[model samples]
Target chain A: MNKSDNNFLGRWLANDLSEKEKKEFENTPEYLAYKDILKGVDKFERPVFDIEANLQKQKEYNQTYLKNVSKGSKVIKLRPWLYAAAAVFLVLIGLRTVFFNTTTINTNFAETKTWTLPDNSIVTLNAKSTIEYNDRSFTNDRSITLDGEAFFDVAKGSQFTVKTKNGAIKVLGTEFNVYSRNTTIEVQCYEGKVSVNNGKNQAILTPGKGVTSIDKSALNSVEIKESEPGWMQQKSTFNQVSLGRLIAELERQYDITIEKGDVDTDRLFSGFFTHTDLNTALKTCFEPMNINYIFKSSKTIELKNR
Target chain B: MPEQQVSVCDESIYDQLYREHAEKICYYLYYKYGDMEKAQDIVQDSFAKLWMNCSKIIFGAAKSFLYKIANNASINEAIHQKTVLKYKSTPQKTYTNESPEFQMEEKEFMDKLNQAISGLKEGQREVFLLNRIEKKTYKEIAEMLGISVKAVEKRMHLALVTLRKKIGKI
Candidate 1:
């Protein structure tokens, strides 16, 4: 066999040769060349576990421990650093407890409530929402179970987890927003790593990254304007967003739906709208796109292509 | 005759699984990622995830689940390391045999095989690894990757062709 035939034979022996090409490399010349190369390939036994005592010790150290400690009335004196260490220990122990002694924080319609988490993290609960967490003590791995929309300013920790109906959000300190309602769940991270896993599907969010999931499947994720988080405070910004998405946000904010023609789905709009009168916010987002909208009623609005 | 049943949710069973398969998983990982530490971490992470979701997983499907998790974890680690290296503005390091001079010939041969394997495109490399290292059937690989059986065969054919050429045999 020639050099090309020799090459084909080598590939066949390596299991890289295709079925159709196998017949071509069956000759003695190609077979001999392949056999020579195969002899040189290193053969190592697969890795096996070492039953060393040290491995067992390491495993024990990493295992989760659930402990509960009640506050005692004695005034025990201790060093400042010792106290900090104790606090950290308490947080770790507290996280091990599956059930939290929670106090519900709720907001009325059109109102918002901001509270500090046990780890000193800040959270702003939007209107008609409630957040529940243990108030007496906080843990090293802080987590909160949520039902509606809340913007979190997560305190830095070793590992933090936020549980919702769809899945759990695990982070290592970051500022973010989570809105889980009905069949839709959304997470927007301002910093650090945030992993969102719903048993089967999973996605990780980085700084300035946001992802939305519907029925446990990731729908779409995009980088938003840095000022987008300020939307809760009425300072909203958009960057190359679809008109449909913009309308949906408006509906969520003002509790009013904007009905538009099918032709306007592809229209893209970019602008900034602050927390202002609903009419002015609507005008700023619509007029530039050459679209006019009319309020059919307090809860509904209609958009027309100009 | 009844087949022996395994429980995916039992921690003891998982511990046994780890004790039994840890080394093989590590070897597979070491071949895929040349880093021993990363291989260990991925194997551990795969087991941890399995432990967390054990209840939802069927016993008979545990092995496949473990393989899937290990595959995903290794991919994620590879991607993460690449990102870290990029952000640090460092040049990519080429792979070489680190075995001592006493084992020079063996090391050289091993390095050649490693180089040839790593040189393949990402898709082809994955297909080859799954088929050869994991010893998975073509049909199983196609199902796991959500591709057609014919596509798997085609990719496998391409991979063998390229590897043979690189080794200078064909």
Candidate 2:
């Protein structure tokens, strides 16, 4: 019971006591009583856990955490390129608009874009097309320069003109499709009236009426009767169009390169094909004409005479 | 040895350590806080934190780290549950399905054991239970409580002496 004697018991339990002292301590009633208490405590169960379940939880945490880290690394890799691309784009836009507040929009191959002009005119640009206009003078001038195909729903206000290198198409509050590529230019009016002008001549186009030109020379106006272009609905429609031009259109729409391997590319082909399936489109274009085609890769194709 | 070198335990070692000490940690917190659910939650949280900083805590000292974090979590939880005090009435299960006579004797012994343990001083109670019930070594108790091994031994001795004084009367 003495405080001085308690230190011996502490050392005895820690096995620090000598063997004779342990033997002597074990014979005491107090040691036996303490052992009984410890035995009682041993009866009480220690809390347990399912190690397998907890380990499974740990494994899941690690997997999800590592996935996030990998995803974060990808984002980090893209960050610098995103900023650089944005900077280059802004610089180009600034340079283009430096003189007259021009807004230039261009779409790459296999891409389509739609934009609203400053005057609330909706313009849907086809693949590989560009439209540039003066944002500052849009309400006053209403003029746009087109390098490729675009469908326009002009807001009714003043005269609207689409100028190209080959010619220009002028309208007022009408829906129309204008296509200018290489030496060929085509303007088809869908709603109201539009006037097409080549370098040497001009023609008036009403709804379902259109005109085509080659090398600044105008062709006779023809009737189309279509409400919209096939490309707008993911279809490529050709009416007695040349194979070379059709192949060029397919290349732009599908972002692929095609080589004419000893085939008459100048032959006229007429057919329609969906844009979602490239193999079907190729079949629709070449199979009916008895031509053989081979896809060298996903991005390259070759056509030969059959 | 460099602390970093000692601390860098791979996943397998950490997993082994978790398997070895996780239940003891849970029971330790449960006895201290009197809430088995809260104790298990704190143990899980401590393991999560340990894994997050596995490279910073030495493998040899991981038990101490687990105890330190588990203790802190229990303290915070104690403060939060002060208003509830729901586990205060949680009676320990003393007997399972057994004869009425055997159950009565078991309950009486369990009541005496609980009373003797409750009669001990706080330090002695912790050291004794962690050692006798949770089966922790004196060195481990010393490291976990940030005390010397002598202190743990003294606490264990005093706890046993007190328990003997309380239970020996019967």
Best by lDDT: 2
CA RMSD (A), model 2: 17.2
Kindly report the interface RMSD of candidate 1, rounded to 1 decimal: 9.2
Off by over 4 Å in 1: A1-101, A136-141, A225-228, A238-245, A255-272, A288-291, A296-300, A304-306, B1-170
Error of 2 at A8 (Å): 71
Candidate 2: tens digits of C-alpha lDDT, residues B22-83: 87777666565555677777877788778777777777889878888988887777764522
Interface RMSD of each: 9.2, 4.8
Candidate 1 C-alpha lDDT tens digits along A39-150: 5332423343463442463255335311111233346878899989999999888876645556788876446789987678888986567888765544744767887778
lDDT of 2 by residue, A125-171 (tens): 99999999887787798999999999999999899999999898899
Please give the lDDT score at residue A130 for candidate 2.
97
Query: How do the predictions measure up, each by TM-score?
Result: 0.37, 0.45
